[model samples]
Target: MSFNWINESTAINLALALVITLISYIVIRRLITAITGRIASWSSRSSHGWTHYLGEIIGRTSRLLILLMAIQMGLYVIDLSPAWESRVSHIWFLVLALQFGLWMDAAVLLWARSALSSKSGHQRSQLTMTMISLMVRTALWAVVLLSVLANLGVDITAFVASLGIGGIAVALAVQNVLSDLFASLSIGIDKPFEQGDFVVFGDIAGSIEYIGLKTTRIRSLSGEQVICSNTQLLQQTIHNYKRMSERRVLFQFDISYRTPTEKVAEVAPLVKQIITSLEKTRFDRAHLLALESNALKFEVVYYVLSSDYNQYMDIQQSINMALLKELEQRQIKFGMPVRSLEFLEDVPVIQRASSDVDESRMVQK
Candidate 1:
């Protein structure tokens, strides 16, 4: 290469620019640190949740970004050719755009964490937030790229048109996946069921364990994990037991028909008292429903004021035991199916045979 010697003034400009860039980088970094520290201190005393999130995002400011910005400042001290100036301006735009994208990316992450932290064990909200975060970051980087290209004198309309066509092709290729994705998003918004909710759909009953982009995982009562696509899962009706406020209980029992009518009438009152005496139970009605061939059929209706299956079982057991004890004390017997047969003959077979043998012996004597 041919030697190109710089004059004293030009040399001084280059030296001065380098010095300025170094000092500026150090100063900017220190300023970032100081600002982040200040925000952190303020966040500690603030009850507002956004303050802490803001501090975390600010702390993520990149050192490379700071260096680039410092170099941008130093460019003001340099005298350069027109072509170099134009190219440097483009670089400046690209650097600044990229830094902004980074900051926005950090903000998105912080917001997602904050949101997810508030809703622990809820996969619906977490998956929804993650999807949204991905969309936002994608949009941010797209904007940055498009702006950079336009700043460098590239025709973005044709580029965007091409991208649109490609996007359409890709979307068509993954139609099933996209359908499931949208279904999952709908689940997040409509809230049909959430993670950790016990649900029954068709013949399957299980608790939701995880929700993914395309599929939802469930742990069935039989101890196997069920992975069902979001679209298919949503296509069916789901009964969410977690949302139940109370359980309506209807049961029947029978007493021996030998029980007196007066005693039969007392049973309803006894059942009502026994049910009402238990915790979280609301007695609705108790009546002698019908009289069958073998027993008096009684119907009892009540409600357990809880969604807990175990709690409801416990209350029902207590009521059952109490009612049984009361019945035993009152000497009222439970009804059981019974059958008997009687012959319409005056003399039994064995007695007639014995008399026949006795007459024979007397004749012989």
Candidate 2:
């Protein structure tokens, strides 16, 4: 048996491909470094960190592109026979998919960085960003799949037509998920509640964290993350407390029945003044309500100009303390629970004892 060494055509092709690959790798790597350096130099360290990370991504992508080009060119140089055409097509398809995936990832990362830099007090914009990323990735994957089908010598147009029919059936089967997805879209557009906004819907109360395709995530007051279907959220009544500019407070108190009517008249204006004088609080009205059996019911109505719950509480406390001080100064006393008692001198037992004593006295006389 005679052993055949490397043929002239194969040797030449292999040597040329190796040289080209090495040169392409070196050139692409240097170019990536240069471009990334230029971009990073334009920003401060805080902002440059993302750019640096992006540079590494670019470098890797460039290397991949160079390798792909080298392989594609090397196939022609090596004179690949028609028998291997299907395998070559498959390889190209895979390489194309890989390239698309990498690009999609890079684009998503860039948009994420932009969203992170947005100063909207909350990451509300991230919902839009995420949706866009998902759509883009989906489109990329679809293209890759189509290419793969075509590379495998499948009739892509007919396949797509068949897929459209199947898609209808699938959509019908997953109508609930589709409905929620559309609801998520509505949430993004209508924006009844945004990320970090305190919202109450039905029995749920929480701050929104994530708005996904089918679900919305919330961080509850108990520090737990609550996942809710977007459809359910949309169908329910949503109360967004973040939009509240002012808060209304209605409360009741009690005054002693012994207090004079004139003193009751003085209490309203005094309480109003005390409330209005406090920061961020306005007294709407204070009225002596219906007289109970034991005390006069007083109702106080006020509005706090601030929406912050803590600030509202602070203002309320201040008004409460001022009211207490004013009541003390006016010598006004709060009412306590009381009951009334009546006594009758003509009771049966007393009458009986008195009659018996009188009879005994008369007998002694």
Candidate 3:
């Protein structure tokens, strides 16, 4: 639309630029408000979900930055010196980069907080979450700063190289600590085990007591606290007993060889019956696996339908107690050592000859 007020140029078109910039700023702000308000309304409809965070991220767009964007748009219609244009371009780059960094920072913080909050009883410490968030933000802002400096015609090659060397030195200085820190993060996110979980890794068996940024404290079976670095803990193959669905059990017992053949044959079926009568047991198979010199060895296999050690013990005890009673009812005797001769007093000494004639002379004959 042609208008008289459109081209009222003065002093590098400051008058027109100001008018345009003000109008643009008003329009953009209104648009942002309307859009963000709608998102907030939608968030309210839900049960305080991620939508609320979405609205906040969008709403956090700085008013000063928005004004600068509007000014950049206004400057598009004006004539300026090469030096001024370069300055304007640099400002634009810096603004956009800062805004991007802010957005990324918000998302990272939200993610870290939610990750910590979501894991119930996982023992992800506040310090861990803070350190993680700080490290990521530091990296992000460093990239943004470098980009801005490069845009302003500063030579960043030397700066980048120096940073690389410095970073290497720092990392090497704290390599062990860093390794444990990152491993702790892995544990928090990947969750091989949680607090109070019974875990066995290598030779260490314990219940997790605390998870820290550098180390994990565990209460061992012998009532001693075992402190292990997160790096060392994660390096080994872990057995999470707390997460075990079921337990496989195999046991062996022997019965006397003198027991009747029928009774020996009945052992397997009798053992199976006893195990089946107990709750939380899945009968597998029972068999007379081997015959010893003095006993018949029977092997029994089954599954405990629980991971609880006490429950398994209770079931085993019941099986053992019932076994002896049932065997007594069937008149079957448990295995015992074979008979052997013993002398109570010394006998008459006899000397053996090395030759046949001498042997006959030494003998009773």
- Assess every candidate by TM-score: 0.80, 0.60, 0.81
**Model 2, 1-365: lDDT tens per residue?**
65377777777888987777677667766776888777666544555456656665665574666677666655655666787865876776777677767866776767666665768525355566577677777777788778777877788998899989999999999999999988887787677887778998877888988888889999998989999999988888898999999999998888898888898899889888888788777778999988998889899999989779999888878877887888888888888899889998779988999999999999999
* Candidate ranking (lDDT, best to worst): 1, 3, 2
Off by over 4 Å in 1: 1-4, 119-126, 188-190, 223-225, 254-261, 288-297, 328-365
Which has the better lDDT: candidate 1, or candidate 3? 1
- Best-fitting candidate, scored by lDDT: 1
lDDT of 1: 0.88
Which scores higher on lDDT, 1 or 2?
Answer: 1
Runs of candidate 2 with Cα error greater than 4 angstroms are 1-14, 42-57, 62-65, 74-100, 113-121, 125-132, 151-153, 181-191, 194-198, 201-229, 242-245, 250-269, 283-301, 308-365
lDDT of 2: 0.79
Candidate 1: give the clashing pairs. Answer: none
